[model samples]
Target: MFSPDALIASAKRTISLEQDAISSLLARIDDSFVRACELILNCKGRVVVVGMGKSGHIAHKIAATLASTGTPAFFVHPAEASHGDMGMITADDVVLALSNSGTTNEIVTLLPLIKRLGLTLISMTGNPDSTLANAAQVNLDTQVSKEACPLNLAPTSSTTVTLVLGDALAIALLEARGFTPEDFAFSHPGGALGRRLLLKVEHVMHSGDELPAVTRDASLRATLLEMTQKGLGMTLILAPDRTLAGIFTDGDLRRALDKGIDVREANIAELMTHGGKTARPEMLAAEALKIMEDHKISSLPVVNENNQAIGALNMHDLLRAGVM
Candidate 1:
């Protein structure tokens, strides 16, 4: 009953059919697409996407994509709109309704109310001649010759085409609005991209008494104590003026041991890297990570313009802060 070859053959056929359906959508991206974009761009209120069943799932995704990419949007189930939920929509909103048949009764019921409010309607339907398309100000034809389903009934290729078209619309508006990565990060502050863009070195670096430091005249044993107390595996060697004179790391301790130098007696200045690579207080934690990576070092001193050591951080600090 478990025939691998038959399963592979069926999967390939389904993929090929879906590929063909998606390719056909390219020719349909014409003036109607531009009008749809223009209508949404000019709208004063948010985009309200509505659909039913499988189409409702795709409508929800499209709304999320539009909202995160600079356009304000949300999804409202068509069936719910018939109830008191219709009040959620306003005269300023633009309605984007999706239905492959363009005749889903729940959606059709809202058309009258949408028209009464004089709201702009955009439709995504397989049948452009259907009632829903005829009522729309602009119709995005998502017609597919056949479904990936062998029975040609389940929505497969058509939903993919609609989703891709929605992504195209969102990205076009994002570009038109000159949306930046910072703008996107603001929308996704809890995500990794937000951590990379919004997290500053000062936000994660150790400062004040937490900063591990010792004078250049200190012994290697004293530096080791400072490193252990700070738990950064390194310490800053400062000059008399509290300016950064050098940095000493675990690697330097290893090299000192190789040279048969006694940690209790050897001057830290002899083993510390003089005026080593540094970061700024306002620098991005991601940028600080880059600097550590480029120099192949694990620790960095946060210095001011006058070369005064203000703070310090290590790879673990970045890792703890989610910058790594």
Candidate 2:
């Protein structure tokens, strides 16, 4: 019995309402917000986030964002805290409590004990005048004009605003700490982002015997054999003293065939590209990929400080390492 048009209309209205709620939050980033950030920034211990029901879900996400961005944080359900989880909070910790109505019984019940422990209390609530806000040292107002739900009972727009506010707080703290991409990579070492930011050419490139190389005076036939044996689509051309002279790739082979050059007799130095694009062992794998893409090449030779080819890598290596 549901109409498609009605469903689309309801979805659009919900999005629009949530957008307005977030927009309203921009003006609410007052001194209280700054105070809350300062408390968390100065805390010697971790941030302890507590909420009930829908707020608890948002609290969990906020805690994750904070932890990943250089802040130590964890979420504790308000009801669970009442049972036995209250032991998790220490005097040095900062408590970040969330309640839309600011009257969540479970959270409210913990306020007395929180005060006794001398922990810094920061509250995010939709009701500015609620008991939770009054009991906190600093209060963040996440008030929304109305719920996105037509019934006005569901925590729709209010939850969206709260989540956005939490993100804003996390980003502010991250910037305050001067968090860098490498710092982020350390926290997410198992993810694709970690590979892109942390994995270096030395970590994935073919080195030692696996690196394909041929002297500049070597015949094209021998260079092709090295390429085939290495399967890197390219071979590094080294001078007599073992320094990088040039590079020969499949593209050069194709051009040689087009010109009808004699592969058996032609020297690799004559056809090789001089001082071709190269990567450093310490360079990020993603940077090597970018260089390959910019030059429209498939392989890169990793060079040392002395300009000697120490390793080799190709697009396939990047793909296999999850750096693509």
Candidate 3:
């Protein structure tokens, strides 16, 4: 059996090796890297990434990062390309090939066809002098001095370096293209970030008949009934002209009871909070959430410029909408 101390030491050694490999890449971001970015930025067609074995897995991830970060890219297996997928390549597209030794047979076999199609080629390889690197218009060198594996044969440090380099390239291009959070949200509409950025108060708030409101002169008992009917734990107190006068919540009821006021006879205007925090219909749900959190409140009344309550939303609505 392996000793605990030995396993910990081995893990630490692997981490140190990979960390050093990543640090070395900082010095290699030179003119070649700039040229590669220029080529991909100017390409009229999507980036077609191809690799074999372990490199292929990294290539797939790189392609996804590129696509989500404003660059159109997809991965194609080198072996599949040789069989029939080569047809996916167009003259307008750019090819990004990956190989550690820069001599992946499956990829090398497609060189002639790539050249014949006159497509611009970019390669990420460990060997600058290898065939794949030499054939590219620009090459990103991801050479690592040694593998993190004790045997020095596994694709450990090398793969990590390649992944970091790919992320660097994607981020550089994203900045060059002036990618924004809204642009990113478009690509990730189903994710939490997207929900926070894209969902507005109008999309999740209870509006129209769903709004709980009562005239300011109404009894605390009537306000309670409206709150229960709307199921928002609160109700808006409106003026005769429909403008907001105040708000009543469960907390207000507790305070009233503490003051020895009878619920059936107490006036809502005296017990309610005067025009508490409000949200707008077009406001982002995230912004509304911030308001609720900052005030330590659980509900918000959506009001227009004239202070008319048009809608209402509680923490539960945001939770159900995945905006919380």
Residues 162-199, model 3: lDDT tens digits: 99999999999999999999899999999999999999
lDDT of each: 0.94, 0.94, 0.94
Candidate 1 per-residue lDDT, tens place, 78-137, comes to 998998898999999999999999999999999989999999999999999999999999
Evaluated at residue 154, the lDDT of candidate 3 is 89
Model 2's alpha-carbon lDDT is 0.94
Candidate 3 lDDT score relative to the true structure = 0.94
Q: After superposition, how far is residue 50 of candidate 3 from its true place, in Å?
A: 1.1
- Put down candidate 2 lDDT per residue, 1-324, tens digits, no spaces: 779999999999999999999999999999999999999999999999999899999999999999999999999998888889989999999999999999999999999999999989999999999999999999999999999999999999999999999999999999999999999999999999998999999999999999999998899999999999988899999987778999998999999999999988998989999998899999999999999999888999889999988999999999999998
Pairing residues by index, what is the TM-score of model 1? 0.94
Q: How many clashes does the backbone of model 3 have?
A: 0
